[model samples]
Target: MTTWDLAVVGCGPAGSATAMGALRVDPTLRVVLLDRAEFPRDKACGDGIAPQVVDLLEDAGVRGVVDGHVPVPRLRLDRGAFGVDRTMARPAWVIPRTVFDQRLVEAAQAAGATLRRHRVRELAQPSSVVLDGEVEARTVVGADGAYSTVRRALGLMPGPMAVALRGYAPTPANRANAQVIAFGTAGQPAYAWSFDRGDGLANVGYGELLGHRHDRPTKAQLRERLDVLLPGASDGGTGWKGHQLPLSSGRWRPPTGRILLAGDAAGLVNPMTGEGIYYAVATGFAAGRAAAEALIAGAPASAGARYARATRRLLAGHLRHVAAAAGLSRHHRVIDAGLRASAADQRVFDDLVELGLARGRITPTMARGLARELAGAARRRPVRRRR
Candidate 1:
């Protein structure tokens, strides 16, 4: 019958960060972190950790979490005969989720949050937030990823999804020490990537948006496409696993109660590049802070409103811009234009990375570089707005 200040479901990046954020706000507040699985468990992901994610973890008081992992400074994008290879402004690390998630959970525990091994089957707000009628808290943050129980409990509509298959293999010599994305011919927004882990191996994967004509790639076909896209890249690969990405195609408005959703549960994955760690940590922290503020103000039911406002300020505009970008990306020529532009100007490359990785909006420079191609890419007449 112990009531807690906050209960966070899911001990992945988002959940751990949520606990850390709440504890940072008021170290004395009681926070419980729960996950169905144990630490060091493998998750099916590209495992590309943006440096921006590291910055956020540092803010959450976990520094050097990616220590000893090699920094991958170069990113390459290719489709058909067009390609762009360049060094990014900031380096990124490729660490398997097995190591990464465990470290974040440890940091949260170190920051005075309790970690529990329990599956949360139900949530109720009849009084304080209650999980499975046993664990009670003033507020709850849901960070349980794409197949989110909290989102289902709240009766929220699931967002758009992209499925990706991931595996580990020895780094191909030509693509070693780099992160390479090869746009697939099967469909728009489909690509295969090989990211060097700096230990003679690379994390390789292929992903494509669902609800498209090319959505139905069987497991063997997915692997076949990977082999064709990057020859020799998948050689001697192991542990191939696939997962769904809940894309942040639109804004997520939390209900007016003590429950809030973060990370993939909120559909916070980046639409342009399928990156979610940054969004996960950022929204998790915001949700945690919002819950903390509501709890401290003695208006726990207001947690959702506080979270909605915070995320609106943080993601609304960015989501809109990325939506526009994603629409244009439906055509392959647009992808070619982006690659060509990035090759010609380092500023364009930096801008594209920023837009894909962090809370970056489309810039005039980006628009100027790709606008004409975009118009011609579709080869369609513009619709005039009604007067």
Candidate 2:
């Protein structure tokens, strides 16, 4: 049996990014990437990448792909009767997961990581994954998404999940060059987004915290609202998809063996916004580097634990901050008020998505700006002019 340096259990952005980082640290280490689905697979996602993600791609020797990313600069946010419009000069890209995930996988292969297409049926720890009852490696990375098999094998329990649904459509002219976020006041925290894909197409989706309802809107009911929002593009829409975002950051303990979890497996996605791609990619890189260092230091079994500690150090505070924000979002009335106040100043909207660029916490400047705007809005309103 030939032993390999690492086996990555998923081919998503996180898995591929980790493999690339590992190879960068030690080019000679043999890395294998395994995934149940093949390249170019479609995933239900908002498909927007922040500029910071661009930096990570560049660091992984993938600048060419980042340069080719589709741009969406204007952001429009709505919460009930209040709304705000903002332009993003820093740049955000709308790269479909199909194209984006494939490129990352190919990049990993080009960087010398082996690609394996097989559903990972099991993970027998202490050091091995049973993929289709076969392939095995000394060290493993579980980048598999929500409900990750690797996480399960490691006995890592995930926290509550955020359910999201999305699909592709013809880019409406009115929606071109901008993205839309509509917040729901009553129910399981619903929000619909429209991101222009630049190729005469757009990605539109709705996300809500699962099992909580405000107005009896079923999945179909909420989707119908989206259909109205996107207009002509929503007609003949056959692509209905949904996925879960694991929010709890899980147990923070990788299995007591040479297996580490990355991406959704590690529950790194933000609870409030369902944004995990960038964090997953960042943590995956950290994991890969830690694993490679462990291997080079002649400590294979401790690699998993080392990866966990490194990932926690890199993300624990950020996760806590995101959780606080998400909790606020759940209180719809307060968030709605915030959104109304934010309309006068767009930085509040920017701070929401740009949390990644801000290193997870909203800056004091942004916080003070938001506070002033809210206070001013409160002062400006006529004292209950009841007609």
Candidate 3:
């Protein structure tokens, strides 16, 4: 019966970041974070934390999120015989979600948001948002990740899904400070990553987009794909886990009610790279800020639309651009050409990183470069990589 200003489900990065964003704005707004699990819990993820996430955390008043983690400054993209090794525009930290999520939750609590270890089984909004008929809030943020329960309550289906298997192992000697990506053959559903966590371990995984004319792979098949794509990397790996990512597409529209979806719940994962942390933090923060403003204005129901506009302005045509890029990448030789172009130019590589990890769009310069590389790549045979 007691209503709070904001209630966020799922106290992961997205939910905690939402609380931080709201409290950072007003600090007095009654915000509650509800989650099914306790702190220091494991999450299935590639565990690559982009510097852009650091920026968002800083804005949310949570610093040192990845402070002690090792940073990977270089990115290497490879395909059957074509490859590119380039320095990232900024370094990325590889921190397992267990540490990262807990820190964010603690930061949110420190910012005056209440944390409750309660699982939100159902959500209903007649006038005010209610969770399981126990928790009530003027506005709700569904940061519950892929296959979100709150999202289902909003009468929406999740977008396309990509499944990946992740585990950690001793860092390969040859890739000490680099995040390596092995692209699947063009037009095929295959890609694998080995990101150094800078602690002698590398987070390794393989994934593919689903519902784009491909069947979802089983766990055994996912591990098999990892073996084929990044051989010898998965050996002796520990704590192997599989999770689904809801890929972002331009088709996403905001809810028409007081509920706003953020993070994986909104399908904000980068279609091109399966990256969601950045989008999760950014959108969650945006939603929290928008919800705070709406509550302050005595129009909490307007939070969804306000959050939508805020994301549109924040993402700035990136959603459409990445959707198109992912489409083009399905064609033969597109990945090869992209790697070739990125290898030849730093600007292109930087652009690629921005597109995958943050809100970056296709650029004219990148287009010209890709076209040139495509033309050149056609004349040569792809070099086969050693398993």
Candidate 4:
């Protein structure tokens, strides 16, 4: 039983990022990276990296991997009678998870973290993780996504979860490089997307509130809608995959235990956008920093609590706004009106950016302006027309 200083379960962006962060913070620290699957494994995702995530990775020295992929620019938002193409001046990258996850793991390995491809069976307190009949590590990190084993071991399961379906399609030569979000295609409250990855291929998928199924299309059915939406890229067959996202921030209580959680294991994904890569990587970096501080300086083991507090400071307002935006989208009419309004003016895009900066969520300030406009319209309601 070679007791290690830290054992990280799951080698996705979150796990690898955390390992890299911890090692960078302390090169001498012994960190073991473990994943149930082998390298180049696939995870269901839209595969589009927003600009914010790109910046974070660059600061973390992983920008090369992100830059190597194709750049995506505009995000086309749509609903039944509403459609808008919002320009993203900052480039977005589209990369296959198989390549991206492996690259991150390799980077972590280069940073002095040992890598292991063993399935983690169980996790125990007071420094121990059971993987392949062996108990290893003085500390364990749960980066294993929504159905997180580390979280389970620590009695920190997510109370609410979201189900998502994703896949890839062939991109036509004529189509523009853009990320498309279509709502009300098959029903209300559910939406599908098509992301041009710039390799004569695109990523297409759909997600809906769990248990809120209507006459909407299933993951497979969305393929037909994809064909209707983008005829040029619809000739190829469909590829379908599914995954789960946890909504709650998981348990941050007693953050000073022998086992810690980060990324999806901690339910750190954005509640509205279904975006988790940046948040996961960010959380991973923070967790690694906290772990390193605990190990090198023998600081109060409550470093994870500090990390959680920092996460809230950085993301709570944005997440709350996400929740509010998601609520608004639940209404088909609102979705239609929002998209239609955005298409009419680039100001909508500017407002969205400002709102995200102001409150942390991707909200369009145009909505508030539109409300004011409506109020003004009511004020001039022909005062002499009293019947």
Q: Which ten residues in a row have the lowest lDDT in candidate 3?
A: 208-217
Candidate 1: pairs in clash: none
lDDT, candidate 1, 171-226, per-residue tens:
97889889999997655568899999999999998888887646467777778888
Give the local distance difference test score of model 1.
Answer: 0.88
Candidate 4 lands at a TM-score of: 0.85
| Model 1 alpha-carbon drift over 4 Å, by segment | 212-216, 372-387
Better of 2 and 3 by lDDT: 3
Candidates' C-alpha lDDT: 0.88, 0.75, 0.87, 0.70
Ranked by lDDT, top first = 1, 3, 2, 4
Error of 2 at 166 (Å): 1.3
- lDDT tens digits, residues 29-67, model 3? 999999999787999998889998998788655788887
RMSD of 2: 3.3
Clashes of 1: 0
What tens digits encode model 2's per-residue C-alpha lDDT throughout 174-270?
7888877777656567677888888877888877666643433456765776655444545555577878788754234455557777878887777
Poorest stretch of ten by lDDT in candidate 2: 248-257
State residue 200's C-alpha deviation in candidate 3, in Å.
1.3
Q: What is the TM-score of each candidate against the true structure?
A: 0.94, 0.89, 0.95, 0.85
Cα lDDT tens digits, model 4, 1-387, are: 677777889999889988988888889989999888978889898887767766666787775787567788777776655577777657677888998888889889988999888778665554344545574665567899988877776766574566666767776554458877766555435666777888877887766656533433465555555555555444564567877777643223325555678878988665556778877787787777767766776653555666667667766776666666667666655565556556666776655543332235554467664454445545756678668
Root-mean-square deviation of every model: 4.0, 3.3, 3.8, 4.1
Model 3: how far is 347 from its true place, Å? 0.9
